[model samples]
Structure formats: structure tokens, C-alpha cells
Target: MMRIRHDQRSNEIPTPAVSFQPESVQMAVMKEKLTDQEAVVAIGQQDVRVRFVDGVPSDRSFMVRLVKQEGGTWVAQAVPLSSIGRFVPASLDDGIDLWLSARGIRLTEKEKEAVRRFWETEGGSIKQKQETVAALTAKQLEVTETHLRLAHEALHGPPLGDLLAPLLTKTEEPEETDEAKGVPVREQTERWEGSRAYAAASELVLPPAETRTFVMTAVTEKMRQLVHDFRVWQRDMARQLEQFSHAVAQQATERATPLVESLIHSLDRMLLNGDWLLFTDMKTETKLLEAGAKLAEAKRGLAEGKMDEAAKTVREVKALLESLRFQPSEQKVMRFFLESDERQGMKPHEQLSRILKQASQAARDNALSARGVVESLRRLGFFHEQEAARALLSGERLPPAENVKAMLLSWVEEGTAPAQAERVLMNLTGQQLLNKFTADSHTQTMLYQWPLSLHGEMATVHVHVNARSGNGQLDWQNCRLYFLLDTNQGKVGISLQAIERQLSVTVETESEKLAAVLQSYASTVKDHLEQIGYRVQRLVFQPMDTEDEERAATDRIKTENETSQWEWTI
Candidate 1:
């Protein structure tokens, strides 16, 4: 594998833009912490360039060959995909495919089909086809009437137009259209029920007159085979129609879904860059969504004519999509169940079926059963304490839980939930949660509201720090910290509530002079938690954000003046 290397460090300079394009994907070499001029120069100069933009995997040997064709301008064209980059040219097949898609190329029939179906189901209005069909039907009727009138005129004395007037008139036929509705709703329902019963009886319920048979032409085996094949055909048709809104319209439904997923993911990456990226990506998102709507409309157009497949497919996707909204950290979400036995071990992908498992049922019963709860415990990154807590919670018939509490606590104390799953096998029966007591891997304490009276003698300080190591690594111990302030104090609660908006503080700490100049900076925060009235549940300092280096660069330039404040209040 060829690697892109520079004698100068990227961090010492600037970062490069990793992007996609058509025909020839461009590779750039950039400095990480570069001066503005260096950054500009790196970008301006084709520091490093890799061509052949299409990234999709295929058997085809599509490639791009670049040439400085006599003139100063270097031209690029598609050629067989080959090695590129560094001392030894390395083929970045992944990037190649991505570049292709970025440039609107695709490989793999499944990928193509997926992209097509997604778009069609997701596309725009499909009603025009139905309207066309109706108009055609009306035209045929008019033609038939005209022919009949001409025949009558030839046979008799009346004018052809006059003879055809009855058929040609646009009068509403109440008898033909509303006959079904004339019957009472109940009577109509019963009539359908009776017809269905009779039809069904002809096949299954009706008695067979073997002795009184007049003529037998069809074979019973062939008829049975026909019925079986017809059923399979119906099922397939229904499945296809359900997938596409227009069951009859071909090719249109095939183009939608991939476009949506691809566009959405790309837009997400763009948003990470900055407001400019956001603005750009949002437009792309809107375009992809609109295209998808159009494709869906096309499918819908075909599936009309009393076919319910399209409707079913739409409904099914609609339901499944609801699940997409909540991105849970663990697969064993309370909302869904796992397929694996709760008593046994399970792999992530192999664990459970969200739809087939009894998760919803257990949820209602407050008995969340996943594959041993061990995986979720590991996911939570609770060290040993949380895992120990979960081990008891899992309700396996291990030794008496009261006695085994120590065993679980040992795991939590070590932050070894993943390891715990492997090392010890405690029967489920004995281990359980004692309502009052719980285990913790690490402990933290908060101090708030120190007295002004004890200025130098016993000055109090409030601080947060993680001092416990579950992995037996001292470095890991310092990765977390928090407070356990004034649980019994009244003013602390009020401060906790209001301070969350913004902490206002004035402090004077000595610099060179032990009693002199300290720094006090005023700051504020936007909404962190709107669920007011709840007591400060350990301010879980868990903030989730995706990494966008480009966006960070832009932000750094923007907030150059925002400096940290020094406060005696921890």
C-alpha cells in the first residue's frame, strides 16, 4: 500500500480537504496547523492530486490517465483503475467508489436497485398516469358510440349524429355508477360477504359430486398446482407493488432510495464544516428529497387500479421509519427486544430481531430482557460499578443475589464490564438489586458555598475531578470528574437551578503579590436542560458532538476573543 507522506508535519502546517468528484478524484496534501498563507499556498498548488473519481465497486476496469498534453494545462481522462499515491501507488478503492458516487456514478446492481427503489417510493406525484388511463377509456367509449350510430344511420333514416346522441351525451348514469350505493350500507356489506362465501364454497366449502359428474376435463393435480403458482405470483406482485407505489410503472421506482441516503449522508458531512457548509448541504438535501418524492409519485402512478400493494409498502416503510428517529447507544433498547436468549451470550449483529422479539412486551411489563444485559452494560462504559449494577438487574438465577452482590460490585469497581462478561459466570437466581444499596466503580464529591469568614485559615473550594481508575490504569482514573455539593443545604439547590443558565462570579486572586490581582470572567450558556424542577441529578457531563475539523477551524477564527475565566468557585 502506497502512503502519502510529507517531510513536514501536517500538524505543523494545515489540513487538506478530503472530498469527492467525478472522473478523477483529487488527492490533496495539506499542513495541519498552517499559517493562513501556507494554507492558501498548499491549496493553490496541486500539492497532491489523485484522479479517477468514481468510487463504486465493479468488474469494469474504469480508470483515469492524466497527461500534461504538450500545453501547460494538465488534462485528465478516465482509464482503467490503477495504483496511485506516494512512493508505491496505492489503490484507494473505497475512495475511488466514493468519488464516483460523489460524481453521480454507481456500481453493483443491488446498489443501483436500492438507489432506484428509494427514489421512486420517495418521489413526487404519480397521479397523471391514472388520469391518462381514464381519458383513454373515455375516448374509446366515444369511438364505439360513433361507430354504432353510423351503423344505425346506414340501416335506418335518422341522421348519424342524432342516432348516436344517446351514447354521446354527458348525462350522469345513476343506475350504472351508484347501483352498489343504492343498497343500504349493511345490505351492501352482507351482499359482498355472501358473494365471497359462495366463491369460497365453489373451491372448498361446496360438496363434490364424484358419482354424478357429467364431464371431467381438468386434472385435480394441475388445478392444485395452478392455485399454488397463482398464490406465489400474487404474493410476489404484492411485494413488488408494495415496494413501489406504481405497481404497473416499470423503471421509475428503481431510481430513488440510494439518492436519498447518499445525499443525506453527504449533507451531514458538509454541515460539520461550518455555516457555509450547512447552507450548501441543506440545498442538496432539499434537492435529493424532492427527487425522491418524484420517484415515489411515479411508482404510485403504476400501483393504482384497485391494487393495494403500494399503499401497504408505504405504510410499512412509514412504520419502520419511526424506529429510525431514536438512535440508541445500545442495541438492547427498552423499546425493542433481542432474539438471543437473555440467559446466554450474544454477538451484536446476531443478537435479536427488533420486530420479532418480545422486547415490546417485556417493556410493557418493565422486564427489559436483552442478551444478558452485558452488551448494553459495556456500551454504557460504566466501568465495573454500572456493569455490576446491571448484572444484578439482569435477573439470572445466579447464587443468592444478596450474597453475590459483592461479586458484581467487584466488576463495577474495576470498570471491567466487558471483562466481567467473560470471567465470571454467576447463576442468575442469587444476584439482584437491593433497593437502598447500589455499587459504584468510582466516587466523586462536590463542595459548594465556602464561608467568607474562613478566608485563609480554612478556605473551601468546589472542584470536579475523576480520581478512580477501573481499568487499573492511573491515567484512566483522571478521565472523569464532578461535584457532590451541598446535598443537605438549601441555597445550593437554588444556585444549581439558576447557575445552570450562566454563572456570574467576581474573584480577586493574587498573582506576583500573594494578595493581589486575580481574574474574573463573566459567562453565560444557552438551554442545557429545559426539564426544570428535577433536582440536580449528577450533572452527567456527557455531551455528544460529531468531529468536524473544518468547522472547528472556522469556529477558532470566530471566537478568538472568548478566553477562559478564573474563578475560586470550582
Candidate 2:
């Protein structure tokens, strides 16, 4: 519970009057004051004047409770710093007990412990903590009430109403009418007919044989359209150059014409040779876009009669295009996807390692965000389409689906580029395929996979949960959770199994050096799990042998019944 104080003796303090606005808590920084009792404080983005009911704190900052008054004024009450530490309990279980007890609901010791352990191993964050707490509290209340009722019945026997009920005259059963019986039969027939019609309709809609082939063909067509747009833009630029002075036109042509021609030639060769995948690197796409923007700037300068500016802009454009002449290779594209940007001040391995650690914690703490990622990709695709449409309407050409698709694939695979509609659609289709395969397997395993972008690099995380199900409800108490992380530093896997509130964890990696690094943090991980209230039965860091990689891959595909032991190996 929270306490608020109102001091009538302090005239400087605003009276605590009720307002329509809800109460809120915020942190505030105390500033130097005009008087002993009056001082200014920074609360969020606003500077507020507050009068202390008690003496003002000597400390620089503290948490404050703010309440709105009827006159639209805010009254601030400083929370004692000492009391703030008590907000989070020393143990998660203790916290759960306290909350339940506060609600006038009491549970047996075993029941209380069970509730506490559920909170520890559950997959949720602070954002959903209260909801989980409320649900658990309600469950305990129901269980306790049931026990009490059972005890009452055992001691007192059946109720007086139950004894009197049997003494009353029996009521005659009513026979079902023909219409009632026919109604159900008719409904059953209609349902069967409707389902049959739906099945027929579904069979008529033939899906693509190979989604990859469909995607490749669509991308190739988009690339061709982009090339056509580029040619039109080139002709428009040539025409615009004529508007400039003769000297400026000659200088611009000398600088820009060769570079533009070279770029178009490269694109033409790639499109004709069916080697667009070689050009999927986001850096190359960005350079190409930058070159276009410079050309547009040059055109604007020429139109404004700034011949010197236009010539300089053309020179910049020439330099940018010259940088794009490097030979594209599979290795180079993979490197582009894996490498972190130098400007971000972190190596690829370091950035990925950090992301992996955060991901491990998030796997236990947060709800899976795979669906959110798909939604984001959809939104981004729509945005890119709108941008392209606007550009077309304005007679300014934006690069076509080739560049957009390249960017989107880069984003999906490496989390480096923007999302495009084609890639989003392709991913959505892939998701459907994944669902089909998973359903066909008839397994009680839940899987979620998503890409995480950090410090200009991307890491993919895959989570698998195996649990028991009865009465169509999953039993999380006896469940196994596996997290697989793929990053520049290599793959790291974590496996957690919880049974009756006891948790065992195994962390595995292929590289011995990486395993050694994670070894130092093993205890920290265990402590964190324990802090959440579950007993840490075992925590192990086992590095896999390089030679065993093939064997490990074979073991992973074994059916649940065939695989006697679950191993977390990367």
C-alpha cells in the first residue's frame, strides 16, 4: 500500500483536492530553493514548484507521487527514499505471499509455494506481471473456498435442502416433440453440406508449387521495371542538363554521364545474366540510392541557375558511382550481412554477444514477438509502396521492386535493410508452410523464431517449448524450454527444464573460447533464476566438440519418443 500526507500547517503546500485525472507516480529531481520549504523540481519534462510537508531532501533526486487538484494544479508528495527499497520484495515468493495476504485470501503453505514457483518459471515480463498475479490469486481463492466447503460438508453432512428435496413429489418427464428432434437433424445436415462446399472451394484454389520460384520470378520482373524507370530518369536528367549554361552542361556531362552509363550497364548485365541475387547486399543498394539522390540534387541546382553547385553535385555523384564498381560475390554478400558498421563503435561479435545475452533473458521474461515481427514487416512494406507511388506521382523516379526487395530480404535475413512488400508477402507465405509442417508433425512443441537487430547487426533467435497437455490445456510445470541463438559469434543454445518448481539449465556453444566467456556469467544466470523464486537444481555450461557437429545435427531430428535425452547443443 502507498501512503499520502497532507499538511494543513504549510500554507505554501497546495490542498489535496480531488480531480478528474487519475493519480500517477513519477521520479523527480530536487533543485535549489527560493525558501526553506519551497523548492523547484524537475518531474519528467516539466519544472514544478513543490512545498515539502516534511523537510526537503538533501539528495538530488527521489520518486514522487503526483495527484491532480480540481483547479488543474498538481500536488506532489515525496516518497521516503527508505520506503522505495521495500517496493520490490527481497524474494519473489515472499512478494507473492504478501500480495495474496493483502487481498484477504490465505492459502496453505504448499499452495502458496506452488503459486510462487509458477510466477518464477512463467514466460512473462513486468508488463504482464500484475495480470499473472491476479490470475494466480483468483485460482488460490477458488481452491481455498472449495476446500472449506468440502470440510463443512464432511462435518455437517448434506444440507437441509438436500434432505427436503428427496421428500418432494417427482416431476414427470416431458417427451421431445417431433419438430425438436427434426430441427437438430436438419442442422447437422446443413453443417455437413456447408463443410463439403467449403472443402470443394478450397480444392479449386491451387497454391504455388514452389514459393521460392514464384518469389524469384516476381523479383526479376520488378527488377526489369526498375531498369526501365532508371532509363527514363536518365533521359529526363539529360534533358534537364540542357537548361543549364553551356559551360555548366559540359562539366556536368563530363562528370555524370560516364558514371550513370556505367551503373546502367552493370544493372543491365545483372538482369540479363539472371544474377540479381549477387546484388542483394544492402550497402550496394544504399550507395545506389545515394547516387540517385545526388543526381536529383544536381538537377535541382541546375533548375535554380546554380551552375557551380550543380557541377559540384555531379562530381559527388560521379565519386559515389565510381565506388560501386567492385565485383559482387557470395562471400562478400554474406560478409555484408554479418559485419557490424564501423561507425557503431562495436565489432560484429561483441554486438551479437550482447544481443544473445539479452535474448536469453527475454526468452524467459517476455512473450514471443514472432507475430509482431511479421506485422512490422507488413507495415514497412505498405510504407515503401506508398513512397514509391508518391515518387511516381511527383515525376521523380524511385528505384523499383528490385532494390526494394533486396533491401527487404537483407532486413529479414540480416536485419540490416528496410522491409519491402514482396519480401513481407514471401515471409507470410513461408509462415503458412511452417504452420503446415508443424501441424503435420502432431507434436506438443511450440516454436517461435525471429530476427533481432542490434548495433547494425542481426541475430536470429529460435525458441522451442515442449510441454504436456491434458484436457486441451498445457501443463507448464513439467515443461522444457530451448533457446537457440545464431549470431556472428556463432550459435549459442540454452535449455531450461522446470518440473514441480525446480529448474535445471544447460548452456552450450561450439567454440571453447565462447564457452569460457559464458562460464563467468553462469552464476549470475543461476542467481537471476533463483531470485525469481524457483530452485535452481542444476546449471551447466557444456561446449560441444567440433567433430560431433554432424552427429548432433542427426540427433536433433529424432522423434520425441525415440530421443531418450534432450540435449541443447550448437
Task: TM-score each candidate.
Answer: 0.15, 0.26
Shift of residue 246 alpha carbon in model 1, Å: 76
Q: What RMSD, rounded to one decimal, does every model reach? A: 35.2, 26.3
What lDDT tens digits, residue by residue, belong to model 1 across residues 1-570?
999787665556655644323233333333232332112112123332322223222322233333322232233443433343221212334443434443334346544343334224322222222122222222232222222222222222222122212221232212422532342322212222111212211222112355112111122232334344434533443354344444223444344343323332332332222112111112222332333333343334434532344344344433332222111111122111111122134322122221112211222222222221222222212223444465679975444221122334444567643332321222111011101111243422211111111211211122222233332222211232221112212101111212212222222222213212111111111111221111222221111112222222111111111122322232
Candidate 1: list runs displaced more than 4 Å. Answer: 1-23, 30-360, 369-570
Please, what are the lDDT tens digits per residue for candidate 2 over residues 1-570?
Answer: 999787867657554533222244445687667566667887644677666656566778776555444343345566664454346544565456445544456677776665555556544444244333443343233333333222222212222122212222233223545643443212212222111212211222123445433433443354454445444544554443333335575665554544444443443333223233232333444455455445545655655667688777766655554544323323222222222121135533333333333332222212123222333333223235545677899999685332222344544577553323333334323222222222222235544444444343444455555666543444444677776665566777777877754777777676767777887887766765554335688776665444333322211311122111333222
Question: Which ten-residue region of model 2 has the weakest summed lDDT?
Answer: 555-564
**Alpha-carbon error at 382 in model 2, in Å?**
6.2
| Alpha-carbon lDDT, every model | 0.27, 0.45
Q: Return model 2's CA RMSD, one decimal.
A: 26.3
